[model samples]
Target chain A: MTGDTHYDLEILAELAEGLLDDATARRVREHLAVCDPCGESLADLAAVREMLAAVPVPAMPLGVAMRIDRALADEPNPFASVPVGANGLSKLSLVPALDASAEVDSEELATVTPIRRGRRVWVATLGMAAAAAGVFGASVLASSLMSAPGGTLAEPPATSVSTPERSPQRTLAYTVRASGHNYTSRELSGPLVGYFGPEPGTGSNNDEQLDACVQDKANELDRPPIAVDRAQYNGSEATVMAFWEDQSLDKVRVVVVDDNCRELRQDGLATWN
Target chain B: MTPPPEQPATPEHSAVAGARASVTDADLLARHIGGDPQAFSEIVKRHRDRMWAVALRTLGDPDEAADAVQDAFMSAYRKADSFRGDAAVTTWLHRIVVNACLDRMRRKSVRPVADDELIEAAERDTQLPDQTAEREVSMEVTAALKLLPSDQRAALVLVDMMGYSVEDAASVLGVPAGTVKSRCARGRAKLAPILSHLRNRTDLTRVSSAKGAELRDG
Candidate 1:
C-alpha cells in the first residue's frame, strides 16, 4: 500500500471517534468501503473503544463533587466583573453563565452598589475639600475688608467663575452619548469640559475618539447612565452630564465645545444626585 | 428541616430532562450577562463531571483534580463573553479543563512517573480480584492500557471509550485532529494483540468450566 493510504489511518481514527467533518468523513468512509486493511483497522479501533466504554468510570471520592459545585458557585460572571486575558485568566473557564447574560438582580447589584457609592464618596470628598479651602480663604478676605479705613470690603469675587470647577485627577463619572451625524456629539460630567487637559499635544482635543473609552469605563463600573438622547443631538455638540450620587452642588460639569476646540458654553453644577 | 435524600444524579422523578430544563450553558450565559447570579449554577451542573474526569486523569490526584476542575470552570465563567461560540460548547469546556489540568501539573515540584514505572504501578494497582467473574476481562484491558503511552491512553479513553469526537478530543488535548487519529490508531494496534490472547484465555475458561460441571454431575 502507498504511504498515503497508510496516513489515511489518522483520518479513520478521527472518524472512529466521530470527530470528522461530513465531507472528510464521507471520503474516508468511501476509502474504507474498498480498502480491507483500513476497514479491519477501523473495526479493531471500534472494538477497543467499545470495550473502554464498557469499563465503568472510577468513582470520585466523597465531597469532591460538592467542592467543585462550590467553586462554580463562587465564580463571578465575567460580564459583570472585568475582562481577563486568554493567556491565564481563571475567569474564562469557570463562570459560563456569567458570560452569557448582563441582567443583574437587585441583591447581586447590592454587592456592586457599595463600589458605586464608594466612588461617589471619594469624589464628593474631594469636591468638599476644594469648597472648604475656598470658604477659609473667603473668611480671611472678610477680616481684611473690615479693617479697611473706607469700611468697604469689596465683595469677595466668586472664585466659581472662569475657573473650571473640576480638578485634573478627580475621577469623573464620565459618560458618552454618541449618535451618527455630521458631527460627533459627547456629554461630560464631573470635571472636564473644554478639553481633557493638555497631554503635550499640539492640536485641538479629540473628544470624538475619546467618547468610546469613556463609555467603556462606564460599562466597566456598572454605573447607571442616563440615555444619550439620539433625537436631540442630530448634529453639532452633544451635552455631557456626569452624575454624582453625592448631592454636592458643584459636582456636575457640562462642556459644549465646537469641532475646532473652541468652548461654546461651559456649565458646572456641583450638586447632582 | 430534613435535608433532601441523597438521590442518584439521574433520578426517576426528576429526570435529566427536568434538571436540564432550568438552564443551559448558553441560556445561563445570556442571563448572566443580564446579571442573574443563579444562572451560573446551570453551567456548573452541566460541565462539572466531565471537568472532574479530565482533571483526575491529567493530574492523577483527587485533591489536585478537584482544584483543577474548579479553576477550569471558574476561569471559563470569567471569560464567558470572550467565548465567540465558534467551537462546540463541549470543546470549549474541554479546552478550559485541559488547560487547568496542565497548569496544575506545571505547578507541582515532583516529576511524573516514567512510562515504564507508571505501567508497572498501574498493573500492580489494578490487580484483579482472583475469584471474580470479571477478573479476566478487567485484567486484560488494564494490562493492555498500561502498555500504551499516557497521551495515547488519554486519547483512547476520550475518543474510543467516552465517545468524544476527534475534533473535541483534539481540542481537549490542544493537538491537531490528525494527531488524535494517529494516537487512536496506534493505541488500537497496541491493544489488539493483547486482546487476542485475552480471547483465547476466555475460551479456555469456558471449556474448563464445562468440564468441571460434567465431573461434578458424573
Candidate 2:
C-alpha cells in the first residue's frame, strides 16, 4: 500500500512545522529530497505562515472599551457600602421587597401578578462566595407585561414570528415540551445539574423541533442544559435553562430565551470570588 | 443638613481607588470580590485591549469580536469567585475570551468568504489612499483566514498572530501543546494555496520598486 503517493498538505506541513515524529519526518524528508513539487509546496506553506505572523493585532476601539466598562459597572454587588467582608456572602441579604412583587397562581396558571426578588438583586458590590444557584429570569417586568394588555416594556413585545400555516405550536419549537405542566415563577430553584432541558419526552415534551433547538443550545453552551421548560419567568413566557460555565466550580449559568432562540434575559445572577 | 449629604469619600477610599494602577491583577480581583466598586473596572481597562485583539483575530468579525469580548468581561465579572489563582489573571481572561468566541462561532456557523468580495469590501473602507498598501494586505490575510475552521483559526491566531507560545496557548485553550502545533500546521497548510497570490504580489512589487530606485539613482 506504500506506493508512490505524495503526502497530503497537512502531513507535509506537520513535517515542516516540526510536529511529525522523527521517523516520519525522516521518511517525508527522504521523499522530499527527491520530489521537487513537494519541496516547493512545503516552502510556500512556510512562507504563508510567516505572512500570517507579520500582521499586528489591532487595539480595541475606544468605543468598544467604554461599552465594556459600562457593562462591568453594572455587576451586582451586595457588600459595596458596608466594610468589605463585614457582611460575608451568606450574610448578604435582600433589602426589604420594595414596591415590586412576584406573585404566582397555582391552578389554571391564572392571576398575572408582579414579581420582585430583592433590592440586593439590583445592586453592585459583591461578597465572593460559591454562587450556589440562580434561578435566572428575564426583565423583572416580563411577566407583568405579558399578562397586561397595552403595557409598555423596556424590551420589544414578544411577537411569535411563525405564520399561521406553520405549526401552531411552532412558537414552542425552541423550548422542550414542559411535561404538559406550565411552571410558575416560584417553581424554579436550586443547583443546575442535569443532562439537558427536561428529558425529551417526560410527559408531553416529545416535540422533536424543541428537542433539536435545546440540543443546539447545549452544543453552544458545551454542556447539556438542566431544564428547557415552557414557563412564566416573572410574567413573560420564556424557556429557562441552566448551563455549566465551568463544571469545576460550584455554580451553573442560567439563561432565558424566547421562541426565536434569542436570549431574553440580558441580566444574569452574579457571585463574588 | 439635606440628609447629611450621604457620607463623603474618606481618605481611605481615595487610597484604594487611586492606587488602581499599582495594585496587582490578583489583588484587584480580590478587591472586586470584596465589593470595591472600581477594582473590576480597572481590571477591564488594563486587559480589554489584548483580549479584544485575541477575539477579533480569532473571529474575523469586529461586531462579533466586540460582543465576544464584552461577554467575556461580563462572565469574568460574574464568575470572579471561580478563579483559583493557579494561572495568571491574563491567562484566565484569555480562556474566558476564547470560550466566548467559541460559543458565538458555534451559534453563528462560520462560512468562508471569497477573496474578491473581501477585497471589494476593503476598497469600500473610508481609509486614506496612502494607507491602502497595508490595508490591502490586511484584508487579503483576513479573507484567507476566514477559510479555516474555528478551532484551527483560534490556534493559529494565538500562536502565529498574537505571539502566544504554543504551550501557553494550550494552557489557555485547555488542550495539549501538541494539539496546538498540529492545528497550526493544518491551518497553515490550508491557507497556503489560498494565500499564495500574496507572495507573488510581494515579489512583483519588490522587483518593480527596485527598478524604479535604480532609475532614480542613474
Q: Pick the candidate with the highest DockQ.
A: 2
> What range of 10 consecutive residues in model 1 chain A has the weakest lDDT sum?
A193-202
Q: Which candidate achieves the best lDDT against the true structure? A: 2
RMSD of each: 25.8, 20.8
In model 1, what is the error at residue A21, expressed in angstroms?
19
TM-score of each: 0.41, 0.52
TM-score of structure candidate 2: 0.52
How far is A27's C-alpha from truth in model 2 (Å)?
1.7
lDDT of 2 by residue, B121-174 (tens): 444221212345556666778878888898999998887777778878898899
DockQ, each predicted model: 0.10, 0.18
Candidate 2 residues lying further than 4 Å off, grouped into runs, are A1-5, A78-273, B1-21, B111-131, B203-218
True contacts kept of 2: 0.45
List residue ranges in candidate 1 displaced over 4 A.
A1-47, A58-62, A74-78, A81-273, B1-22, B57-64, B102-147, B193-196, B200-218
| Most TM-score-accurate candidate | 2
